[model samples]
Target: MYEADQPGHGLDAIVAQRTPRGGAAQHGISKKYAMHHRSGPSLWLWHMRRGDFDAAWTVSDVVLEARRGTACPHLPRHEQWVWDGTPLAGRRVLVRCYHGLGDTLQFIRYAPLVKAVAREVIVWAQPKLIPLLRTVRGIDRLMPLHDGAPDAEYDVDVELMELPHVFRTTLRDLPREVPYIHAKPLAAFTSPIKRRYGRLHVGIAWRSGDWDARRSIPFALMARIAEIPGIVLHILQFGSGLEELPDGFGVLHDVSDISKMAAVVRALDLVVTVDSMPAHLAGALGTPVWTLLHMEPDWRWMAGREDSPWYPTMRLFRQERQGEWGPVVERVSVELIRLLSREAPQCASGRSGD
Candidate 1:
């Protein structure tokens, strides 16, 4: 007896469970399909990493279909999977944000698309993001996610990550539009910063969340960037890495308020960050951003692509080898110099100073 709530049931039990007599349409997909994709999650990631979205969606359908009626009430929202090939034609869709801040930022672009068809679009997002997400177009209402039941009623539910699959998105048709979420420029940050007109005000964030330390570059290594001329660095990193910043490297800004953070990011001329929330935020706001990636980054970054299809203004700097920041930093330095050399006159004349 395999139980959906059992902590250690694993994939073997997932496929081995006897299907309800009603069969595939009853939400139990074919056993042969399940057996072939023994590692469904890994296979899905592998397909996505290789940019085979059609194949990835096929794997997603089978995986999601297999668990259509299953229940795991004890799991946290972030761990619980939602959406089961449900159509959103005329339903009240509850778009749940059961993931990290960065994940929410990246996928919120799909809200307009969802609103195009659904009767009502309700976003249950992380509390910190509510102020910022309020500015995004097409959301009928916004609710801050909490420990209790959701505040709104909906005909169907889907996790924010599932939006891409729901739309059957491909690299060619990915929602690549910039500035989907708008943030007013912070008067405090904008007025003072504009006074310094000649140097480019480049915001830099070198750390990522602790779940994956590999995604972050050491604060000391950021010296390579600090040495670059004609660019004034503003430190966008918050939490643990601030202590590691050497004296006079950059001006550290408070990122406690996400809305203010968005305003600061929008005010900057360019953002250079690791694969973190800032990267997603900058990309979402349509600001020019350079994302430094680990050798094997998350599947979203995909494999061997310098520019992201999801963000037209983003440029990627990938590690040729795992755990080596030297080459990645060197390449960024060269590019920074070239960019400054080309944009010098405009940067000097422009108000934001980039």
Candidate 2:
């Protein structure tokens, strides 16, 4: 996908090769798996679609080892061997966030778990995300990833996404504990400009990062869900898809900043978003969130599922057909109606008090 002028049907071959029953047997090349991050998170995506997480380590490790051949300044020519999954009690440890913001949000839950055993845990992350991640439970230090690793001597280091594999996790062993992350809301966004117009305040995100369109929801389709009764919908999206929004809908402006976005999510009665960062943020905060997914969604959501093991607060609403969100949105609207009905009296009582 990185190559714009790539060969014909390149993706079909890539997807087919990595599919569960595909020829990429033994989890690697020619009947065995190779530890290469070069494939990016696609390895995770592959196994995740099949609900197989045990191989996550193998994929991530391949990438870590492959770093030796790259020009990455931080991954100099082998000063120290990569840290195998060992007890970190007295050893200095480093953890780098090498993926997207959403992956980082999902995996950072492991940092506190990592910190429990490690003597010290230093996180090297995207410069912009540092401020947001600083408050997470187990991190002793947080720094932005510059050209190279920071000037610090460390006994061992690991990538953030690799922690799950290091721990040998299974679906049964997922850290379903919500509220692992601690975020501070911007004081500036203390109140919404518009007063309550519905019984339930719902925050919605229909677009993802500027990468692929596979996971995004068209504003036109998403707007239909806003038509549901007793629900106030606020857009939690930013970037290119902004122009497509329906009139009178407010864009979730402060949401572009993860921390402030978190604060906003924390305040919502419920979050209805596509498979994006806001869903992860809402889940991490233990807020009630309904994740509207694409027909063929990411591996994290898994296949044929309505709930996520990663976040107890999250409920999945998947598209019934490819490139079509109407059914999904309609189903969500029905559920929303049912949910708001149950809360009608409570909403009425709260309004009376107000």
Candidate 3:
């Protein structure tokens, strides 16, 4: 029933079907509606991603209260029940993130907003985010929820991404503040990068995880981006994309940690990546990032837009046709040349000194 692709189906239909004869008034406050609905929160996210803010807010509150052994069984079982909108004056709140690195990076911007009310905000995050998210402000404490890691104590718990719905955020109200998470360029790589290649200093990350083949491009196609004149290309790939490069090509640095990777990113003139965490990281660091996207793109990038609201420094390169990367790469190459020609090259802001 909740299939997103189903014809004539929408959030309003679910709300209407679920609401009793008295409408939202009857079903809203009713324990029956609150307890029994299983797919409400997922539906909320579906609408939220589609930019239907009004429809998404309907289930925001109830879905969060979901827990094991209750009538609500929405989210995975957390040791402690989440207390939504609870004033955290002197409370130690646990901001546990369950999604992938990209999701965590995107939503962790709300940490400062959460800090305004909470006395102490402890971020319980995956190992990958620890190196980066550790730099986020308003976090009183940070802990890694790595494999075999033990649980800790807190007054309340929350899924980090859901903070947007809790705060009633709209497209206009999004926090576009750069450097929400901070990392410095490690001199170890920076010194070598500068001494060797001092052109435009472009970084390329052409792949995402293996789950989505559509989001990734052939490395051979990505190498074509290096053909741009007077611009030094650095491969910012992780495991799979790493390989021996052709001579006179970009250097693939040995970066095992996020902090080290971020530092390298900060040192670059620009980062060209797919829709992934590195793009989010570059945007977070206030770096000039040009992100290539798929035809049916992620909701965060929005539609028919070259710029993103979440990251002011980001310029999007989208696929004109589905299952194609040639057009996207061509446009990116043109933009790279244009950016390199500038006396004082810039993305959004001219903070190019870093």
TM-score winner: 1
Rank candidates by TM-score, best first: 1, 3, 2
lDDT of 2 by residue, 18-80 (tens): 233323433344323433324545665677666777765456444344333323334221122
User: Once all C-alphas are superposed, what RMSD does model 1 give against the true structure?
Assistant: 5.4
**Positional deviation of residue 254's Cα in model 3 after best superposition, in angstroms:** 1.8
Residue-pair clashes per prediction, in order, are: 0, 8, 1
Candidate 2 local accuracy as lDDT? Answer: 0.67
Per-model TM-score, in order, reads 0.89, 0.77, 0.78
Candidate 1: where are CA atoms >4 Å away? 1-28, 349-354
Model 3 has an lDDT value of 0.68
**lDDT scores for all predictions?**
0.78, 0.67, 0.68
Error of 3 at 347 (Å): 12
Off by over 4 Å in 2: 1-47, 55-89, 184-198, 345-354
lDDT ranking, best first: 1, 3, 2
